[model samples]
Target: MNFDERRPIDILETIGEIIEAAREENNLLKLEESIDILSTLIDNARFNQREIGILNYFLANVWSYIQRIKFPDEEFPLETPELEKQIIHLRIANRLLKDTNDNFKKCQIQTNLGNLFSHIGRFSEAQEYFNQCLEIDQNFEMAIGNRGFGLYYYARVVFDATQQFIFMQYARKDLLNAIASNQVYNEAKYAFAGMVKQIESAYPLKELNDFKKYKDFYKKLDKKEINYKKWSAENKLFINPLNDILTESVVAHDYLFIPTMILKSDDKLFFHSMFNQLKQEFVSVRFLFYESVNSPKPHFSDKEVVLMDTLDYSDYSFTLEKIKIAFRVCYSIFDKISYFINIYLNLGLDKNRVSFRTVWYNNLDKNKGLNTKLLTTKNWAMRGLFWLSKDLHEKEFDTTIDPDAKEIATIRNFIEHKSFKIINSFNETWTKKTETFEIDRQLFYDKTFKLLKLSRSALMYLSFLVYDEERKKSIEQSNELTIPVNFLKIKDADKI
Candidate 1:
């Protein structure tokens, strides 16, 4: 542990060797010691992006092994801050290695990210990370197998037949592909074997004609017989385009809109309205963001007063203004989702005090973790939203899902209460303590886009959470004779 005379890279390598040896020998105590040293090194040492990435990647792997060693008899706690530390480390590694030339390491980090998210029951994000891994290395067996494995769990928890069938068919294909690859991974073979047994034991899905048709539909997609782009564009569905950065997120969001019949209830009306509002707000923000990036001219109303003191003249443009609006509005949507949770769940917290960062806890006590209502609901999507909220909260010195979460939070605060500026230059000269939080226009734009993706995920999770609850209600009240209620779809002509 004494690395006083060693270079940072040397220290990192030493720790990696120690951790690997410990893992190979099953030395729990030595592994725990290696974890502590690596954490200390990460906190205290100064290293370039590549070195730090390697360090975090090693730490994440060691922590995963430690968790399995410690909890041999049970699944890792789905909502624990302790378990999320592994996620934080892997995400940090992923961000740091984003531009690295090492394709194998890139694939590894992404695969670990997917695995952690799946282990914690955040299957939506898990699938996205897996998709990202496969994008980097399409034939990566681990990513393929893990994605299939995650989908099986995802299919189990979901209540819709369409979702279940789609996930299972894809899962089967990925698992088979993983198994049939030239270099077979043992884990993939094990997963496929386990999956086969489970499906064969409970072979009810194939009996449904509707689900059988869904399998064929997926086959057509695989065979390229169906033009997905044409189908999606014609139907106005937000399907994933190939190689899109937001492909998985878009796919997840599209699935949330699949038609489902629910009995009429007062809460249903309110929930539906909130879902609509969230969707509209998200779409508006998304449009404004793209418009800002794509617009050629700055449009302004002549009636608006031009005050020199009110603007940062250094980089003043309508595009920047539009981007700022998108960022602020996108940030607000998270709190609005929190408001929805408070009212819908009847948490009875003070309405004005509810926040996305604090709404899930009992009396804002994060130590108590999520409230009993959320825990009892048994909805994975709701739990996923709770975990997503953690990414936006102020973590002091801790690592958040977004490496720049603290700065993003500061920018949001300044935009609302003080001054926030977007400049072309971002260098060491800018002080963090300044009243104006200045950032480069490109960085600001990137963060805003990231926030939009996060907001999209939050909205999707909210919709699915409601869907899960509605399905549960229908099942519980199956014998009740409820009156039929019809709802009309909002056409393009109905847009405001």
Candidate 2:
């Protein structure tokens, strides 16, 4: 029967009739007809908001079911383009829920979006959406589990030769989160066990230790009366030194030994280069940590520790010295400039009403101006600046940048001298009131970090430039001194 001929009650009855007919036929053609009838009813404008939402949900389900039947394999076609149609359908469903302020509706859309993304191998994005769904309704156990599973699956896809270590770390986090939020103990247990198996298969050497840890976790959950058997059946235990050591070290700042062999005389240089590359890598990692703070995930404490330890053994002492020296020089310049600006120009010395103009004008009054105390205070300021610079520089350098001893020393001097002038210029142009500065503390912090990060980048680039120049000159003069690309590896020490 046509939708126009039906009353509101009749429409409801018609929907039920369509559903029953579709189910009774159990045929694709009849199912399609039922869906068409529902669509026509939905378009009639007679349905209220609730009915529209329900009808849309039903339509989504029908589409999902059809897709499932057409492509039974979750990993069908392998090519992303083949999934474009499915993604489009999912997107349509998601858009329909945009105005759905109800938490349940939001959860439904997010869950479906997550599922669609996961199917297409976009696990990270899928995990994010699934987590959103869970946040709206923590009791939505399926979404919670899917979020974790998505992370695990995504980790698997990216767990190739280049970044296997990173993948394993992420995998561990996803699996752990999945189990924690799991409602059914069997589900959690089984997922956890499966992860343990994957870990073992991927990394065999440290299997005993890894298995022991998983066994301990499993036993704890089992003691709590969680489904131990299901978990045991699903997951096999295994381990690797990298994962075990890294995880332990990160979670607790404990040291761990990572074995290596020096195959060539140039191994040290390679290690040094790798060390330098890690500065940017660690920064990126830190940024990721910041971005992923909202997610139900674990911290990369082990990865951080591994990176830090690796740096420590890779000429960390020299790196710190270089950074400290550079910082001291930069601070000296800043101190001198700040002193002139504050005491001579009277820029920042007011206890009551402070501003650049007032400070400058006050400094013009010789009676209220420059004194031993003022100069001494400038030195103290210099020391503070020096400390801040040194701390940040050391952190960045030790974690990321590795330079040759001579080159590092040169860059340190260059930055100390050059950056001081830059800071002086920037400060000289300071027109805002001191009160304003205090009011916007976050702005100041952000600006400070930005300047420091920029200065660090410049210093790194200049160091490389100097090295390149030296290499070119040497080449022209004679081939006696062959500088390696990575300063650290110029020695016969070790490979990264």
Candidate 3:
């Protein structure tokens, strides 16, 4: 390893070899001595870009590994001053390698930086680094695990509720990708599973996208495709699993309700009719709103859609029309859920007999507390079980649910109060954030999808809650002789 006659590459390999052997033998003093010599060589030499990059990267890698091994049993908060030393080395390495198109070096530096930034809670910068590393190679495990790690923290700090879940969605999505790609970090699985367990214990009725999460993960893994794209799943692309939203509507109905002697034939028809209406709304959403952004068949040309508008007020009506229909579609999915449950509970024969309904019907048609039930039917769980999401299950529900509720709450207010905030997030770290009544196309697309997911989750939970109570009362009655078996067959069809 003589510096006088040897080439720079050979000198670096010699230094790296000594450091590796020292590390392998558990000789901490020798490892530090090797790093010191390598560091001195780097500081004293003036080499070509490739040589300098290699040397700097080696120094950074050695320092970073040494910090982890410094206290083998210690937890990796990555907060020690030694880790900060690693950050400096990696930054120098990244700068030296910037001119060269060496992805391995780029990924190595960026991943270390992401880890340090995440520990410091600078999530925006951390996300940037992790994403950059993944761009070099999606299968890069450090980037994958650290990217998910950054997202989890970002979700914690974000102020907007709807925006928080969007972060978590990406968080869970990528973390699962990291897990499925390879087993580089056994601890990543443990950390992720712990987070999920906490989420469940905190929220009683919380469902992770109906617990059919990240099916896209398997699709990507199956193909062995590095060029795989995300943000394009049929369910994830737009709001409302556009490909199979219809199936979900019926599935929600069957899973939430149980047929009993109290359920009349007309009540069954009423519930079915509500779902049919929901199918229509979801169809309109796909055809009118989602299709416009998803394809824009009429406007696309030369691989981009250029909007050239010369008319002054003409654009106004069309924009308003889009808003009206999109809102209507999203609202219908939500509004009908209340109607469906209300119909089943209030339209039945035993409504007058029950002391409490334990739910509220949102529609004006049958919300009169079932036959005006003469004496008193207590508003047991508030006006509606989910009024302000005040129920026990809602109280224990995950933070994810509230964001959806927050977004949908604003929508409800828009109709009832005639004014609501439509927040348009300009870009990452919010270079421009505004609460304008005017619709930003991309913002609406994102918010609408979140609202759709929330609506589905809430309805499913509500139906389960209401029917669960009904089943309890029915059990007390022991009315097995009068129970309907037809609906029981469909009950297991959508159990989460």
Candidate 4:
């Protein structure tokens, strides 16, 4: 962590920023990492009361924030041991700062407590704390937004339209007031954006004639001003969209059809690299996917009901081909990187004295080849990619496998092993409650696409590292690389 090189507060602030990003992005890896770092700091750092209080506050609240976002429709009853630990941290922070006169800090704790209470359906206790925060300071911008968000979340589970309308009316007002109180604060803007979304698309409140006035809150402004689209994109793409999660019967209607890239059109490297053949193959698969989505065969009446996956592909053979090719693509990427690193490791050695060919011929673990043991398994390969590209230790990166993405390893394993385990057998049924040997095609395609995307991203990133390292080695050996006439590319015959 280079802890001695950085100030303690700077480290703490960085951790706080990471935690906030996790909440905004719903990144479980980032959230878990921020918690681990904070927990370590609390146990190890010799901080004073205020710093400790701050650490405890973050340790407690970040978990609650994630749970609230992940399962907003239901109460996060503080029954789980994890939630209980967060509550303990909040309680510790509360007691630590009780004697202090930090109104803002006290108000934050109060709001957090209110949030926990509301999550557990203790509405009266939740209201008491929110009212206490407002009583502490009527203009506390965060507390104001907190009340608005709390109301917005509460309105999710409430049934009556009249009750929802009333709660939303107050929420919109509090969110607006919070923005007015702090024009530059991101929290206020985000809360205001949430309020706008709920009024427009999230809930069926359009018929409330009185609620139409709330449309002025967003106004005919530029789309970027409210950043509603940006928030929605973050919700889906940052992590997997969880709208249908937290329920077994959820029918996912949202899908990333064709999975377009967000890169600029002028970025030639995506299509013009030495691995252009594999890139084109991947793109071909995407085109097949596009065709599958647009194809029509069956028609159903409005009365008909059939369980269907929103994200699906009809081209099963081609989908499997894409996955197998993605594995080869991932292997090629690490192989190139490993080759360059091995070259760099032998840079200063005397080839004539030790016979570089002898070292090269040996199948060392670090050898840059597909068959090398450096990252023999898919799990190791995933972790190894980060190590090659990043200057940080593997421990420092948030490297937990996403639940959806973890299936990538199993599919890859079955592909490498040619096992029918990828498909369920009749014996694998869930105690005969459902049909046996059913394949979750949605899960298969989703995970395979994840591996494809993961390999591409890691390949592109490590390619730059390989290019620069080889360039550095060429320069060290006093052989300047020849530059391409048109594109100004550098090619060193001596470099990998």
Best candidate, lDDT? 1
Give the alpha carbon lDDT tens digit for every residue of 1-496 in model 4.
4455676688778777878888888787777777778878887656678778888889887777666666687643323444555556776787688777777888889887776655543332354467677777777777777677767765543334555666666667667777676432785587577675766574454453354322233345575433432332322211111211111112121221111122233444432244334444444443343333334543233225444542322223433444455554443443444443454344333333322122222343123432232222222222324332321112222322222323444444445654422232223333233322224545554544444444344443333334333344444533433432123333547335
Summarize candidate 1's per-residue lDDT along 1-496 as a digit string, tens digits: 5888888868877787888889888788997787778777777747778778888898888877777787777555556544676778888888888998878988999988887776655666678788888878898988888888888877775666655666666677677777787666676688686885675565454642233321223343543224443333232324221111222322322435423555445325566677778778877776677677766666674237564753333477677787898899889999999998898777988789888988888886566666888777577888888778878855432446656788789889988899777776565556464967788888888899888777877776777777677667666746645654455677768786
TM-score, prediction 4: 0.32
For model 2, the local distance difference test gives 0.42
Whole-model lDDT, candidate 3? 0.50
Off by over 4 Å in 1: 4-11, 24-26, 43-47, 156-160, 182-184, 196-268, 300-313, 395-401, 431-433, 477-485
Once fitted onto the true fold, the runs of candidate 2 whose alpha carbons sit more than 4 angstroms away are: 5-26, 48-50, 73-75, 78-86, 159-496
Maximum-TM-score candidate: 1
State the C-alpha lDDT per candidate.
Answer: 0.71, 0.42, 0.50, 0.48
Better of 1 and 4 by TM-score: 1
The list of candidate 4 runs beyond 4 A from truth reads 2-8, 17-30, 61-82, 148-176, 183-496
Location of the lowest summed lDDT over 10 successive residues in candidate 2? 232-241
Q: How well is each residue in 227-275 modelled by candidate 2, as lDDT tens digits? A: 3223212211001212211233122211111112222343343323433
Error of 2 at 255 (Å): 24
Could you give the candidate ranking by TM-score, starting with the highest? 1, 3, 2, 4
Residue range 1-496, candidate 3, lDDT tens digits: 3587877767877887887787787777876776777767776655676666677667766776676587786554322546545666676677678778888878878988887666643444466578678777777876886677777765654434554565565566666666665656677777776665554464443444444432233433434221122222234222221211222221211122322334433434455445545644654554455444444343323335345653321122343345556665565554455455554555443333221122332223223432342113232211222332321122222322122444444454554456433333333333223332333455656666644444443443343344445555656755333434344333435745
